[model samples]
Target chain A: MFAFYTIYKGYFRTALIVQFQYRVAMLIWLLGGIIEPLMYLVVWRTVSEQQGGSVGGFDTNDFVVYFIAVMLVSHATFTWIMWEYIYRIRMGLFSVMLLKPIHPIHSDIADNIGYKFLTLTVMAPVTLLLAWFFDASWRPAPWTLAAFVPVLILAFLMRFYWEWSLAMVAFWTMRIDAMNQAYIVVGLFFSGRLAPLSLFPEIVQRAADILPFRWMLSFPVELLLGRITPRELLIGIGAQLFWLLAGYLFMQLIYRAGIKRYAAFGA
Target chain B: MYYFRLFATYVRVGILGELEYRANFWINIIQSALDLCVALGGIAVVFSHTDTLGGWRQEELLALIGVYFLIGGLIRTLIRPSMIQFMEDVRQGTLDFKLTKPADSQVLVSIQRIEIWRLVDVLISLPVLGIAFLRLGASLGPIESAVFAVTLLSGALIIYSFWLMLSTCAFWFVKVENIQVIFMSMWPAGRWPVNIYPTWLRAVLTFLVPVAFATTVPASAVSGRITGATLIGTVALAAAMLLVSRWFWRVGIRFYSGASA
Candidate 1:
C-alpha cells in the first residue's frame, strides 16, 4: 500500500508538470468537450419547447438541470486513454513504458486526474457560460448530493478500467479504428450522451442498465439531478460496484495477455 | 486538368495499397455502416416524437442526412485526410519534399492522401437518398435537379475551402489538429436541419462553419424548398471562400518555405 501511494504521488507530480507545460492545448481540448454537451442541451431544449414544454418527465428547467449534471458527470468520468494508448503503441512509446518499474496504469491514472484538474479551469468557465446562456438551474437534495461523490468516484474508476482494457486491443492489432468506432457508437447510446436512458426504448434502457456504460455516466448524473429514487440509487451503487470489480478483473486478464502477445511479436 | 491526372494517379496508388489488405475493406465497411446506423438512429429517435423538426418533415430531414453523408464522405475522401496529412507534414517538417515538386503545392497537399474506404459512405448515401425521395413521393423537375446539382457542387467547394483555410492555420499553429475535433463536434448539429437551432447557432452554422450551405441548402434545393436568395448566397459564399482559401494557402506556403530556408 505504501509503495502504491509513493508511486501514485510520483506519477501525479510528473503529470502535473507535463500538463502545466501544455495548459494552452489542454484549454483548447476542453472547448471541444464543452461544446458537445452544450449542443445536445440546445437540441433537447428545442425539442421540449416544441413539444409543449415537456418530454420524458423533464421540463425545460429540468432538461437544463439534467444536461448540466450530464456535463459534469461526463467530464469527471470520461477517459481519452484509448486513443492515447493506440498512439503510444503505434509509436513504440509503450515499450519503454513497460520497462519501467511501476505499472503503466498508474501513470495513466495520474495523467487522467492531472488533465482533469488542469482542464477544469476551462470547464468551469464554459459550464458557467452555458448555464448563464441557457438559464440552467437545479436543486439537488442533500442526501443525493452526498451520494454523488462516491458514485462519481466509482463511475470514474469503472470507465477508466473498461476503456483501458479496450485499449489493450491495440497491443494485439494495429487496426483498432473499427473497434474504437464501435465502442464509441455503443457508448453514445448506453452512456446517455445521445439522450437520457429513460427516453430510450424499454429494451435499450434495460440493456443500458445491465451494461457498465450507464454506471459510468448516466447513473451519477441522475443521482446529482435528484431523479433516482432511494431504491434506485442503492441499486445503481450496487451495479457500479459489481462493474468496477468486473472491469478490474478484465483489465488484469487483458493486460497479461496483451503483454505476452507484445513480447512474442516485439511491438 | 493536369492536377486531375495526378489525383487519379494518387487514387490508383491508394487503391493498390489498400487492396493488399482485404480485411481492411471489411473493417471500413463495418465502421461506415455503424456510423450510418448511428445517424439513422438519431433521426428515428427525433422523429418518433414529432412529425416535423423546425418545419422539416421526416423525409426532408432524411434527404438532409443523405446530403450530410454524401458531402461528409467527399470531404473525408479527399479534403480532410489530405489536410490531416498536410498538417502532420507541416509539424514534422516533411512538407519540404512536396514543395520541391513541379506541381502546385496547394494541389499536391490537397490530393496527397486518400482513404479509398470512404467510398462506403458514397455507396450507402445513394440508397438512403433514393428511399427519402420515394418517401417524399414528389417528382423532381429538371430545373430543380439541375439547381440541386449546382448547389451541391458549390456546397462541396465551400466545405473544401473552409477546411483548407482551417488546415492552413497549421503553418502558424502546429496544434491545429484540435480544430478537427471541434469541427466534428459541430457536425452532428448539421445532421438535423440548421433551422432547428436558435438564431445565433443558425448564424454560426451559416456563416461561421458554413455547415448550412454544405448540407441544408443543397437538401432544401432537393426538397424544392430553397429560396432564390439562399441559392445565390450559397454560390457566392462558395466562390468567395474558394478565393480566400487559395490566397491563404499561398501565404501559408510562403511562410512555410521562408521558415524552412
Candidate 2:
C-alpha cells in the first residue's frame, strides 16, 4: 500500500507539471466542454420561453440550474481514455506502459485526477459565472449537498473504470473511432448530457436506468440539484456502487486478456 | 485561370490518394450517420418539448441542420484538412518545401489535402434538405435558388478565409492547432438559429468566428427568412474577409523562418 501511495504521488506530480505546461491547450479543450452545456441551456431556455416560461416540470430557472449542474458534474467525470488508448497502441507507447511494475490503470487514474484538479480551478469559476449570468436558482437540502461529495467520487471512479474498459477495445482493433463514437452517442442520450434524462421519453428514461451511463454522469448531477428523491438517491447510489465494482472487474479482465494478445507493432 | 487549373489538379490528386484507403469510406459513412443522428436527435428532443424553437419550426431547424452538415462536410473535406496539414508542416519545418514551390503558397496550402470520404456528410445532407423542403412544401423559385447558390459560395469563401487566417497564426505560435478547437466549439452553435442565442453570443457567432455566415445566413436565404440587408452584408463580409486573410497570409509567410535553416 505504501509503495502504491508513493508511486501515485510521483505519477500525480508528473501529470500536474506536464498538464500545467500545456494549460493553454487544456483551456482550449475546455471550450467545447463549456459550450455544449451552455448551448443546451440556451436552447432549452428558449423552448421554455416559447412555451410560456416552463416546459414539463422545469421552469427557466430550473433548466438553468440543471444544465449548470450538468457542466460541473460532466467536467468532473468525463474521460479521454478511450481515444488515448488507441493512440498509445498505434504509437507503441503501450509497450513501455506494460513494462512498468505497476498496473497501467493506476497511472491513468492519477493523470486524470491531476488534470481535473488543475482544471477545476478554472471550471469552478466558469460554472459559477454561468450560473450567475443565467440567474440560476436551486435549493438542495444540506444532506444532499453533503451526499454529493461521496456520490461524485463514486461517479468519477465508475465512469473512469468503464471508459478504461471500453478503451481495451484498442487491443482487439485499431479502428476504434466508430466504436468510441457510438458509445458517446449512446451516452449523450442516456447520460443526460444532451438534455435532462427526465426530459427524454419514458422509454429512454427506463433504458437510461438500465444502462450504466446514467449512473455514471447524471445521477450525481440530479442529486446535487435536489432533483432526485430520497428513495431515488438510495437507489442511485446503489446502482453506482454496482457499476463501479462491475467496471473494475471488467477492466481487470480485459487488461489481462488484452496484454496477452498485445503485440509491440511499432516498438 | 492558372490557379483554377492548379486547384483542379490538387482535387484530382487528393481524390486518387484517398481512394487507396477504400475501407475508410464505410467508416466515414458510419461516422457521418452517427453525427446526423445526434443532430437530428437533438432536434427531436427539443421539438418534443415544444412545437417551435424561437420561431423556427421543426422542418426549418432541420433545414438549418442540413446546411450545418453540408458546410461542415465541405470544411472537413477540404479546408480543415488542408489547414491542419499546413499547421503540421509548420511544426515540422516542412512548410519550406511548399513555400519553395512555384505557385502561390496560400493557394497551394489551402487546397493541398482533401479527405474525400467526408463527402458522405454532404450526401447525407441532401436527403435531409430534400425532406425538410418536402415537409415545408416550399417551392424554390429561381430568385431564391440563385440567392442560395450565391450565398453558399460566399459562405464557403468566408469560411475558407477564416480558416486560412487562423492557420496563418502558426507562423508565430508553434502550437496553434488547439486554436482550431475554438472554432469547432462555436461551429455547433450554428446547428441552431443564431438569433435564438443571447445578443453577445450571437455577436460572437457572427462577427467573431463568422459561423453564422457559414450556416445560418444561407439557411435563411432558402427559408425565405433572409432580409436584403443580411444578404448584402454577408457578401460584403465575405469579400472583405478574403482580402484581409490574404494580407494576413502574406504577413505570416514573410515572418516564417525555416527551422531547418
Name the candidate that leads on lDDT.
2
Candidate 2 fraction of reference contacts recovered = 0.77
* lDDT for position A37 in model 1: 71
Q: Model 1 clash pairs?
A: none
lDDT of each: 0.85, 0.90
DockQ, all models = 0.52, 0.80
Q: Give the TM-score of candidate 1.
A: 0.94
Q: What proportion of true contacts does candidate 1 retain?
A: 0.40
Instruction: Give the CAPRI class of candidate 1.
Output: medium
Every prediction: chain A TM-score: 0.95, 0.97
Candidate with maximal DockQ: 2
Interface RMSD of each: 2.0, 1.0
Tens digits of lDDT, candidate 1, B199-247: 8878988888888888999988987899999889889988999999999
